[model samples]
Target chain A: MALDGRIEQAVVAALALSKGADAPPRLQAALDHAVFPGGARIRPTILLSVATACGDDRPGLADASAAALELIHCASLVHDDLPCFDDADTRRGKASVHRAFGEPLAVLAGDSLIVLAFEVLAQAAGDHPRRAVDLMRILAQRTGMPGGICAGQGWESEAVIDLAAYHRAKTGALFIAATQMGAVAAGQDAEPWEELGARIGSAFQVADDLKDALLTPEEMGKPAGQDAAHQRPSAVAEMGVAGAVSHLKDILGGAIASIPSCPGEAKLAAMVRAYAEKMTPVHLSPVRG
Target chain B: MALDGRIEQAVVAALALSKGADAPPRLQAALDHAVFPGGARIRPTILLSVATACGDDRPGLADASAAALELIHCASLVHDDLPCFDDADTRRGKASVHRAFGEPLAVLAGDSLIVLAFEVLAQAAGDHPRRAVDLMRILAQRTGMPGGICAGQGWESEAVIDLAAYHRAKTGALFIAATQMGAVAAGQDAEPWEELGARIGSAFQVADDLKDALLTPEEMGKPAGQDAAHQRPSAVAEMGVAGAVSHLKDILGGAIASIPSCPGEAKLAAMVRAYAEKMTPVHLSPVRG
Candidate 1:
């Protein structure tokens, strides 16, 4: 199936899970806000891709992992937009949660998403408690402290930061989780898949940094130049725009090459290569102009 | 084993699971902030108590459940103190997360706790995948949208509010979750336990409102009148302190009476009675002065 099909299936599953005879209207609204006109759904796409590479018998698990990842992403976005963090007024070309529903609800919404992510994963992986536990650990690690996205957010408050650590967490962590989770869902070995994910995630983050340097706010939805404005270190800051572009290419190349020889390797490899190629020079070109 | 002993064991187990090999310094600090001098580990206690009541040999599950519940509570507190929500400067008589660490680290720490809660629960209940799923679902519902704590936060934003709904969410939801989760951990049917927990949680919220109305800032360890200041509807506002006190007794009575006949019935029943009596007006006179 195409990435869009897989994402739609994941979104549908997520929406279906949110339903209950006792579900409150506010909760329904919050769930809707979480998934409607969703962001890239890149995590799920990667997860599905890896799962497909492994085998096709695990579509349900793939969808569940995708939904869980999106829930985490949505939670982070809700928290990130709070006044304490980015204070973003808009997301996905619309008012951010704090802006739309107010701060209190926004916080709650984020909290709910975090809880729901685990719920979805647990329910979806009922027979695979070990995998679920492992997946939960991976997701939690990426979401929180020291080497997680939350830590990445913390780096912004400091006087100085290690850019590599920041990139790895702020972007790479979830992507790493996606592939690892996907591989686990498919009953494949997790470590090699995690490495592939890390590379892809790192490349993706760099591409994002390049876009932030080169794109207009209209193109990217949120404000551009935030990295430079905040003096948040980035590949673009360290390597310059052209150098960053070249680096993204190298990272993407490595990511594509890392996909192991397997039964569905051709399709999976093609998807990775296509995604990276399209993400790198082509996306960067528009932003630079 | 005694409740305190169980708590210690659970904490040790949870801490051992922390990432970063030696347990990251920041996470260690957070664990202390979360566990030690912790506000009642009532949820986990109830879970163990319920499990004991159910004749389950697995007190380990309950202990882990308690630790996980505490983590969730800690996570919520960290988020609650952010610049956007209560914006409180202190928690548990000490500096709130944002005040102690920077806002960013505080956010990350909170997120970590939320993630850790799920991870612990997943591992703790590894032997019972169905129970783990149930626990996750129950936790998600209590913490997630509409009726969950998150939805409760969202309700604060609207121009109009339902006072009962607000109280149910802000305080009661987690309490309900705790009882239900404890019941599940004990491998018992959830209905009776849920009823007991709901009543207790409702009464607990009323008590919290009473605390807000009656306690001095020194006694409460936080600003006492902020709810009224924010014009947020509270039990004290709707019922008056004395009326709220009466309601607490009624709710506690209901909760105690709802406990199923079981091995631990006498002890659990006694504890509930004592807690309710202590909270009631007749018994509260001594503490009032």
Candidate 2:
């Protein structure tokens, strides 16, 4: 199956488990809204790609890991868009979960998705117990405190924010989880994939900062310039748009170079290059000018 | 160690894992405040006791299960007290998490705790991978949709609520997790223990409804009469106070009768009896009249 179809199937199956007759309709609807019409799904794609590069020994576990990472990412988006935080009115060209479902159901939906992620991993443990545990650990480490998305969100409230650490936790953690979890799911050592994940993740953040600074809401399909509105630390703010773009290019080069020796290394490098080109600031390109 | 001490240690250790130097101070404070000075520690206590009754074979996994159950319960209370929900001012005689940490931190703290629960379980997966997976499944099943606490909370928003299903999902689910997880952690069948958990959980809800309708905030250490305030379905509302009290007694009787045959069955029976006595409405006694 195609990566998007596999991920969508996994997510749909997981959500269906919760849709008993007595299940709360609003919460269910909010969950579907938050998941469907997903963004680029870059994180899970990287995960599945890495798993394929590592030989894709356990297909079920790999699909579950990819689905779990996306679910956590989706949950974070829902929570981040809450009135108490960025208060985003729209996401992916539609109303944010809170805007559509009300804040209470949004909170519950985010929470339900988080639990659903773990439940998916646990259910996939039927034959590959060790791999399942590794997947769970990676997902939890990236989703929670100390160096997860939770820590990333926590950084916003701090008097002092370490720009690198903040970006890594907030955006890079899940990306890193994608790479490492993919390798582990394929029965390979996850360490070799760490640097690749970090570089790609950092590049992705820099690219996002550029978009947040330069794109209009119409262009981005979400609120724009949120970095400035929230007074949040951003690569564009610290380095200027041109400098941030240059940094993104440097990180993408490093990410391509960091791909480890594997049977599918060439294919993986090609995928990273593709993402690099896609995320490049087209308007800033001299050729475009 | 005593059950309370074991549970306390597990929770403290889990929170400590998140207290990196970079962790947000306010979020950390809120997480601590939500957990410390916990009210009764009822859920973990039941979990540990059930594990003991099942032979306490895997002590580490059992302790982790107990702690995970309690952490999830704490997280729910924090979210329940949010402004969009109860907007309560106090919990366990202290300011609620949102009241103390502000709504943003409260949401983050709750999210952090939920992830922490799974992290604790994942960390315990080393020697007993299957058991760990089982524990995770039971916890997620009770914490998420269909019949989880999330479903319970969702029931409140529905136009029609099935009181039994609502109570079971909202309150009974965790209790079921406590029993089932304990058994699974001990390498025993979790199914046999389900009825015991369900009956006890249902009984506890009735007792709580009675307290909410009859007691003062000072007595409950939180806002009272919230069911009526929110127009939520409650035993006291469905059946009058006297009828609710009688129902509680009957449920407790069934709970005691539901204890499955095990080596520690006698001790488990004694524990249930003590809880039943403690939760019995004092004013309903003839001696009090």
Output the lDDT of residue A69, model 2: 90
List the candidates' TM-scores in order: 0.90, 0.97
Assess candidate 2 and give its TM-score to the true structure. Answer: 0.97
Off by over 4 Å in 2: A284-289, B223-232, B284-289
How far out, in Å, is residue A247 in model 1?
2.2
What are the candidates' individual DockQ scores? Answer: 0.45, 0.77
Judging by lDDT against the true structure, name the best candidate: 2
lDDT of 2 by residue, A212-267 (tens): 88878999999988889988888878888778878888999999999999989999
For candidate 1, write residues A1-289 as lDDT tens digits: 4677777777677667656543445655766775678877888888888888888466677788888888888888888887777888888999888787777667667777787788777777756666666666677777766566766665565555566676777788889888888887887877888778899888888888888888889988988898888777788888888888888888887887888766888888788887877687665763544
lDDT of 1 at B178: 74
Cα lDDT tens digits, model 1, B5-117, are 78767866775565552234554465456556666666666666677677766666777777877777777878787877778887777877778776756766777777777
Question: lDDT per model, in order?
Answer: 0.74, 0.87
Could you give candidate 2's per-residue lDDT for residues B1-289 as a string of tens digits?
A: 2788888988888888778876667777888999998888888899988899989999899888988999999999999999999888988878998888788888989999999999999998878998998899899999998789998998877777787788889989999999898888888998999998998899888888878887777777767888899886788788887788778889988887888887799999899989998888576442432
Give residue A103's lDDT in candidate 1 (0 to 100).
71
User: How far out, in Å, is residue A75 in model 2?
Assistant: 0.3
lDDT of 2: 0.87
